[model samples]
Target: MTQHIQEAYGYIFEPKLIEDLCIVAAELDFKEGDQLIEIGQYIKKMPLLLNGVIKIMREDPDEGELLLYFIEKGDTCAMALTCCMGSSKSDIRAIAETDGTVLMVPIEKMEEWMTKYRSWRNFVINSYNNRLKEMLLAIDNLAFMKMEDRILNYLKEKSKLAANNTLNITHQEIANDLNTSRVVVSRILKKLENEKQIKLNRKSIDLAL
Candidate 1:
């Protein structure tokens, strides 16, 4: 565990802080589709992703859910950090997008590291900035981008995160993420297919663009 943290996240903290993390960090593995954190649940630990992808989503009463952003290898959840600081529960949901491992640090350690280690403080600030940027991008797409353009951007982003142009997702699932009806998603997808931007299978989309 110590060696793994040193190799993957060593640069984020000083040697002593790293040693402290090694002593307290708990490793957890999650299968695809597993919920790591759910809305309104208290966060007991802060997770540092080591491998695979976790999708952070915001749920809506009428819209179901909207994809906010993704946290991949070597990233931390800014929402979880927020919960650790003062919030009692989480407002967003985090689900494992693929089989992955994460190092969970107890919430109590957060303030200690922040005060004791300058690097840790910097890491936390950087994480918040990155998350804020991604969230703003999501907002821009939802508010300003056309539906077709938004779908295209969604496909491109998912392809990159999956590390393949081939996407194993259903149209209905896409509709749910985009907060639109499946019929609308299908029509737009068909248009994209006619333009040769994507090749559609029963439950998958292969991007040609």
Candidate 2:
């Protein structure tokens, strides 16, 4: 556990703070598609990613869900930090993008560490800033980018996260994440394939660009 903490966050957190985290943090393992946090659920623990990826999403009562951003190893959810600070319910859903491990730190320790450790405070602030930027990028994509461009960018991001050009994902999954229809996704994907940007496969896509 200590080694995991060191590997994930040693540079961001001081040795003393890391030791404290190791003492209080509970290790959790999650599989792909596991719902780590849900909308309207009260947050009890803040997740610090140890390995793999987690996708944060926002729900719309009428439009379904939109993917906000992806948090990978050494990252923490800024929205989760906000909920922890306010003692509020989660407005976003957090799902495991891959089989991963995380350290679940008690909410009470959030404030305590903020006051006690400068590194923790800095990390919290930086996380909030980073997440805000990602949210803005998501908004920009939705408001300005064409569906095809958005789909390509989304695939590129997924590919980068998976560290592979080929992605084992379906059109429906892409539609859900992008908050669009499967028909639209399929059409755009076909266009992309025709343009030699990506190769369509059975339940997978191979990037050519």
Candidate 3:
């Protein structure tokens, strides 16, 4: 656990902070598609990603789930941090995008480290700023981009997250993330394939652009 924390956050945290984290943080492993945090759930611990990707989502009563952004290795969810600081339930859902490990830091330590370590304070402020920017980008995509374009952008993001052009995902999964219908996703995907933007496979998409 000490070695893992050092490797993941040594540069961002002071040695004393890292040492304290290894003492208090609990290391956990997650498989792909695992739900780490859900809407209305009280956050007791904050997660620090050591490896892999995690997708943050927002829920709507009528539209289902909308993908907010993805957090990768060495990143922490600002939404989760907010909930921890405010002592409130989580409004966003966090799902593991791939098999990964994370260090769960107790909420009590969050405040202590803020004043105790300069690095921790900067990290928290930067996380909030970065996540806000991503949320704005998500809103922009929804408000301005066409459906086909949105689908293409979504695929491109997934491709980058997966570190491969070939994505092992389905139309329904894309629909769920984008908060659309599977039929609509399939139709737009087909259109994209026709436009030579992507190649459609049985349960996957090979991005060409």
Q: Against the hidden reference, what TM-scores do the models get?
A: 0.95, 0.98, 0.97
Angstrom error at residue 68, model 1: 0.6
Of the candidates shown, which would achieve the greatest TM-score relative to the real structure?
A: 2
Candidate 1: clashing pairs of residues? none
Write model 1 residue lDDT over 1-209, tens digit each, in one string: 88878866886778998899889989898999999999999988999987889999899887689999999987999988899788588999998889989999988898888898999899999999999999999999989999999999989988998889999999998897888989999999999999999999987999995
Against the true structure, candidate 1 reaches a TM-score of 0.95
Worst 10 residues of 2 by lDDT: 80-89
Query: Which ranges of candidate 1 are over 4 A from the true structure?
Result: none
Candidate 1 residue 63 C-alpha distance from true site, Å = 2.2
In order, the Cα lDDT scores of the candidates are 0.90, 0.96, 0.93
- Candidate 2 displacement at residue 86 in angstroms: 0.4
Local lDDT at 157 for model 2: 97
Query: Could you give candidate 3's per-residue lDDT for residues 1-209 as a string of tens digits?
Result: 87888888888988899889988999899999999998999999999999889999999988789999999988999999999989999999999999999889999899998898999999999999999999999999999999999999999999998989999999999999999999999999999899999999887899995
Whichever of 2 and 3 has more lDDT, that candidate is 2
Q: Which candidate number would show the highest lDDT if scored against the true structure? A: 2
Q: Write the per-residue lDDT of candidate 2 for residues 172-207, one digit (tens) a residue.
A: 999999999999999999999999999999979999
RMSD of model 2 against the true structure: 0.8
